[model samples]
Target: MIRMYGIKNCDTIKKARKWLEQHQLNYQFIDYRQDGLTAEQLAVFSQQLGWQNLLNTRGTTYRALPAESRNNLTESLALDLMLQQPAMIKRPLLQRNDTFILGFSAETYQQLLED
Candidate 1:
């Protein structure tokens, strides 16, 4: 089964969910807000896709951080921060099998959706 992780209020997540439904794809939505995320899960995703791809530096959550914290963008540090604030991470991370696509996009979903 596919696992989609993101906040429920994000517009991108909304679009991704809509696309999945329209395509009749079955995916378990994991909202980090309510359910929260484990450090082990973060480490696994970071290893699979790297922290750079998982972190959303341009997001409002990132921008709101202190300049000093923002300046430090190391993988370990970023992972630690993201583990605390999942919202700082990218939205609609679609995990299927051993691979995952962070961030939402219909094109990516189309390519990965079950056929």
Candidate 2:
């Protein structure tokens, strides 16, 4: 089963979901704010896709953090921040089996899903 993780109102997530639907691909959507994210699940994502890659440093949630919390960030600190606020994680985290595709790109999705 393919699972998509992100906030419902995010434009990127909306686009990704539309792409999936247009392609007639079935997926399970997990809205972090509504469904809740677990520490274990976050750890697994971090392990598979590096903490830095999973973290959304450009998002308002991360930028709004104090300089002390945002600067010189360690893996543990980043992961903790992401866990506390799932919005701090990158959007449209698509999971298929053990493989994860972070963010959305039509070309990338087509290639990955075709494999």
Candidate 3:
């Protein structure tokens, strides 16, 4: 089963959920806002997906950060910050077994389901 982590209100997450439902794929939706994350979890995600991919630079949370807070951030610091503020995570993180994917599109989801 796919374990999906994301905020409930994000458009990208909505698209991912719709795609899964359309494909009859079973998934567990974890609302990051409600459930939250730990620094260790974020670190693990960074290792798998990379901080560059995990960070939501386009999101308001990221853009609203102080310049100094945003600058000179190492991967460990970024992971810790993301854990403190789950809104900093990219949307629609889908995990199966240990394989993880961020974001969604019909074609990519179709390929994943087939695999």
Candidate 4:
């Protein structure tokens, strides 16, 4: 089963969901706010995509962090922030079996799912 994880109100997540629906693909949507995230799950994603890739530095959550927290960040620090605020993680994290995708893009999604 394909699972898409993100917050419900995020524009990127909305677009990804629309794309999936338009393509008639079956997917399970996991809302971080509603479903909550676990350390084990974050670790799994980090292992698959690296902590840097999984972290959403462009988001307000990251911006609101102290400068010391953002600069020269370590995986441990990133994980702690992400655990405290799931929104700190990138949106539209797609999972299928052992494969995991960190963000949304029509071209990437098409290529990944077309196979």
Candidate 5:
């Protein structure tokens, strides 16, 4: 089954969901805020996409962090922050079987469909 992970209210998540539905693709939306994410799950995503790709540096959650926490971030630090606030992780992390996709983009989605 395809599982999409992100906050329900996120615009990117909305777009991803809409695209999936419009394409008639079956997916399960997992809202980070309401559903909550486990450390193991975070680790799996981090491993699949790398902590850098998984981290959302442009988001408010990341910006609101202390300078010390944000500066010179390590994979360990990034994982900690993501565990504290899943929103700090990138949106619409699409997981299908062993494959993992980070963020949303129409062209990328199209490629995924093609694959």
Candidate 6:
């Protein structure tokens, strides 16, 4: 089963969902806010994608953090922050079996389909 993780209201998530539907690809959308995220899940994502890649530095959630919190962020701190606020994590994390594709791009999705 393919699972997509992100907030439902996010524009990127919306686009990704639309693309999936248009392509006739079936996927399960897991809204981080409504569905909730777990430490173990976050850990897995961190391990697979790297904490730096998973972290959304451009998002409001990360920007709203104190300068001290954002500066020189360590893996433990970043993981904790993401666990506390999932919006800090990157959007539309698509999972197919053991493979995880982060972010949304039509070309990437098409490649996913081919794979």
lDDT of 4 by residue, 14-81 (tens): 99999999999999999989998899999999999999998999988899989987897999989988
Q: Which candidate do you rate higher for lDDT, 3 or 5?
A: 5
Q: Would you list the clashing residue pairs of candidate 5? A: none
Q: Could you tell me the lDDT of residue 67 within candidate 1?
A: 98
Candidate 4 local accuracy as lDDT?
0.91
Q: Model 5, 95: alpha-carbon shift in Å?
A: 1.0
lDDT-based ranking = 2, 6, 4, 5, 1, 3
Model 6 C-alpha RMSD to native: 0.8
Query: Per-residue error at 91 for model 1, in Å?
Result: 1.0
Task: For candidate 1, write residues 6-107 as lDDT tens digits.
Answer: 999999999989988998878899999899999999999999888988998888888998999888779888999899888888988999998799887777
| CA-lDDT, candidates in order | 0.88, 0.93, 0.86, 0.91, 0.90, 0.93
lDDT of 2 by residue, 1-115 (tens): 8999999999999999999999999999999999999989999999999999999988988999999877789988888889899999999899988889999999988987887
Residue 79, candidate 1: Cα error in Å is: 1.0
Deviating ranges (above 4 Å) for candidate 2: none
Shift in Å, residue 108, candidate 1:
1.6
Model 4 spans > 4 angstroms off: none
TM-score against truth, every candidate:
0.93, 0.96, 0.93, 0.95, 0.94, 0.97
